[model samples]
Target chain A: MSPSLSWIDPGELKETLSRIGISVDGPPAPPPSFRPEPSEDQPSPPPTPNTEASPPPPHFEPVISVAERIDRFARWLEQLTHGAPMSIADPEGLLIEGRGLPEPLALASVALDRALRPIRGLLGTHQVGSVTLEIDGGRLVQTIWVVTPIGRVALGIMVERPLEPGRVELVREGLRRVFDW
Target chain B: MFGLTIASQKGGVGKTTVALNLSYAMARRGWRTLLVDTDPAGAIGLSLTKKLSQAPGLADHLYQHTPIAGLIVETKLKGLGILPTGKIPADESERFTNGLADGAVLKAIQTAAQGRYDVVVYDTPSGFVGATLGAMRASRYVVSPVQAEPIAARGVMRIFEVIGALRAKGHPVELLGILLTMLHTKTQSSLAVAEDLWKTLPGNLLFEATVPRDPAFLEASAAGVPVGLLRRRPPPIAMVFDQLAAELEARLAPDAKDVANEPIALVD
Candidate 1:
């Protein structure tokens, strides 16, 4: 059985924030609408118009194109992994973006992603978080499959050493941020 | 002014929701509050008023030296104000993030808000780098909303590590506590995660109030209003924020007397 949850009391929590220099004294009186109920004898004032206007609906065109996003993602990945060889491709083995990836290795990475797609489908899973492969040359190839607003794409990186767990988490977060997954 | 940042390492953890409602709650409690949106994507603007998309905001102020005072968008809520992310060009987004890394923009905001606001709440983008890091560095306190899931639980350690590093460097940023959000009471996995977190984390590190997973939040978001304003009478879930606010007030000012506790004469 999992342990039941318990948290700090209000006094202790207050002490924590106070020690950090947060002011305990409240601000001045709020707006009229936010004020407490009026006394029985006090006549209610006429209701004032709400000055806050409804903002226009978002009709702005997409500022960043798919190609630009891919390019930015590639650049961000390269910087994140310290210029490690990286490639991004569709499931059909089409190279959408890459940096320092030899043509053959890039193609191979996409092929690997392509091959895994059917396996994932057969297993009733639409996405694979990540896969790590050790090639013959002692290099590690890490691939993260992400489903973005555009489509499903595979991000692969080649590093001489195994990527640290924290780094991998960062990479995953970067993927989410850049790709809007 | 008190600087509080709502941050999380993982996405979809209800950071924006917490920031939005908590700031509004604080404002309703008579605290002049400024809600600053630090996400390059302008999430706060998008979530609330859509017209702010074209307004100059934090990014504009950071990059173009725009005055922070003029950038503030007043709301119908008297004590509540907002500093939207403004328009971030696609190509200049990286530059904007890089600009925030130095913490200058946040410092400027705090300086500008000093006399104007009683508290400043920052809603940061996901991940601990760039703008989030800048906000953390500039804030005196941070509250992380941890989604009730195993993956989100794993991400809590990263927040601690980052806060630890910040304090080690003498930045004086405090981790107020971890708030459990999006809890699904019916889901055993979610309950288990909450239980595990309560058991694993120190008592003072976790908040007592937990935000449940309610369809009302979705409804509120669709309507672009905080849960407190969802209906003529807000749904029951909206009261959780008031509870959370009371808890926060108690924590922020432990010695402050509670006027609500005072007795009222039967006839006067």
Candidate 2:
């Protein structure tokens, strides 16, 4: 609905689906927290410079980092969500996969809506392919994911499978840590 | 040699079938071929040789920095070599993608394959996840197989978007072609869908022969042998495979130049 000739934003759909208690299995566990101060095991990275005064590197490094992160997250999703296959509709139409997995996925789309609304004014969203999902007894139990310019994000839940509450808590916390939510 | 990564954003698209037959075809043509299975499902290993419970494949080589060629295990199939990912591809994969700054396995294999392999086929995992990207980065030419369906065509387009993004970022990887499989010609819908994709997909239109869906691929899957090796009935599918093999061979010869050499053309 947002745009013609494009794929749907799976993250938004996932949030909406989570609302009705659908869980998904594919999306990455959010990234390890980016601490302002270095963790004990690792030495501190080079100190941040004053943005106004510091010149950006001649070659862009942050862009490369994001691409690498997508790869990292994609790997996580692929490993856990081995069974189901997801696909993006033409262009950016709603992401679809494993038919009949709607109820819980619809709810996860709701949850995704809640999460992205706050960030919408700041970061634009991306359209990724169908989240891997299974239609198990008409309830969803897993998370799906998509890769974006900023990083890899979770696709909405498939109603066929609901997220396990414990794992949801863990991923929720991880999302909080990743975005400082 | 253009290192080719065969990937699918969706599974059950005959990715392994393409990989297996492609390997057999290469070997039959007297090319030194290596099929690398980055798929955790281990379909390549399962199809090519005995199921491996424990062994050093890509994950081991990537995580432990094992010498790439050292992991090569020659198969019963004469002109082929397999570098497999046994049981722990996932566990070991996390240790690398989550931890390493650079591609460990890609670097290892590419360096070892400078002259050793005339063709390297990477059987990618299903989906647009990390494994597929890693496989794509390792190979400059990507060969994708899509089920000849509307939904499947969408997957093919999405993957091209991915390939396009990578190339835009100077990844230098190029899509070789989008090959259609499971040709259900009886269905008008499927045929129409294929017709539509020819107009949508990018790059050189491959030899026009489509790989017809046949029970031989399944039987070979059951027997853990390449379809090209199966001597069976309805010889048509086998003949299709022969044509498919020749088209790929012509396209993938080490001397094969960049796709840019010819103006990029869509199927339309």
Candidate 3:
């Protein structure tokens, strides 16, 4: 006697495999003639033929990068400093982001960072919080450095009017928040 | 006395370094800590005091019946004491191993340290046999130091098996946690291994504090002292041990309130 063939549902097979921690691709889409009945309250939208030309759906949440965060912070600091020159650098004194800062001041910030980098050990050891330098035009180049999990980050601002100690602390706190230090 | 044995299956996984610095950190925290070297290689003695390397230590006490009290070496830290692996002669190495294989020598050491030290940290050699097994058999807790490398991470299971077997044998030894050491964040493989361990291991199985790969450890080893005492101001890496010690205290006594949480009077 010949045995009758039995077919296993692809969806059931996929679910069983997934339950056992084995991932397999879902079954191919059903044939066009097998469309499901739309619910009365929420009907499916009409299919659009030009799907490839349409823009992708917007994401409700967007992921932000550290470099982008630093850039945003630098721009905000620039507005606070009244368009004064400013820059932010990594632990290695490499510029991550900058705003309206002159070449001389940027070089000076990097130089200061390199000079003080050796003395600074780990995150909590002998931390050099901030440094201020007087330039030729009676302007103060104030630099605040913070050690983040990523590494040390410095924010330098050149302005004729120096920010108060509290304001400088606010800047430091802002940098810390940006890096989640 | 609280007994902690630093055990690992792989060599150079920072077991000795963790044991040495952890004991120092505990001593600094006002715990009368005694560091006992169970390794026949005399790593603890060589790392701390050169003079004590040749001196009679735990091995001598086990083999020749030397007094444990007399062999305890006082360190610069007032709260810390050292019992080095003294003079494991090549001829009597087998005897020493046999002595450690049995738990009587460890019981004697514990008895001697009962009232003297608040905590006794044992620095065992690599592998879960002989001296290491003896130390674990005598210890109330075991903390495994796993280097942040693929092979070292894989060896962690052997520690679990050893601890499990000891418990099955009715030993009161509990696995404290696996400490990831010598982690280089810049190295892709190192970071990957550390991340994998953190994600894969149970929340309570791994320590929150990690030891970074630093040259200061070598400097401290050369100077024959704990990394915390390497310079006038302790290196930043030294503070990692302080964090580890704090975590250990928290794990060992979860219900106990931290002294730091207590507020002090400004006038006083």
Best by TM-score: 1
| Cα displacement (Å) at residue B218, model 2 | 1.5
Tens-digit per-residue lDDT, B1-268, candidate 2: 6578888775556777888787877777666788887765456776655654246677676657677778887877676888887556333444433332233466457668867777778876566666678777767678778776654654444565676666666676766666778767766556655665543332253335566567777677666677766664534566665666667766664556333357767875
CA lDDT, candidate 3, residue B100: 89
- Report the lDDT tens digits of candidate 2 across residue range A56-162: 64763332222233234334434444423222221122232321122224335435544554565565654322233344445444553434332444444333355
TM-score of chain B of 1: 0.94
Model 3 DockQ, alpha carbons vs. true complex: 0.01
Off by over 4 Å in 3: A1-181, B254-261, B266-268
Comparing 2 and 3 on TM-score, the stronger one: 3
* Candidate 2 Cα RMSD (Å): 18.6
Docking quality (DockQ) for each candidate: 0.04, 0.02, 0.01
Considering only N, C-alpha and C atoms within 3 Å, which residue pairs clash in candidate 1? A13-B251, A14-B251
Cα RMSD of all models vs. native, in order, equals: 18.8, 18.6, 21.8
What is the clash count for each candidate, in the order shown? 2, 58, 0
Clashing pairs in 3: none
Ranking by TM-score: 1, 3, 2
The C-alpha stretches of model 2 lying farther than 4 A from their native spots are A1-181, B52-54, B89-104, B199-203, B232-235, B252-268
Ranking 2 against 3 by lDDT, winner? 3
What overall lDDT goes with each candidate model?
0.72, 0.56, 0.72
In angstroms and one decimal each, the interface RMSD of every candidate reads: 14.6, 18.5, 22.2
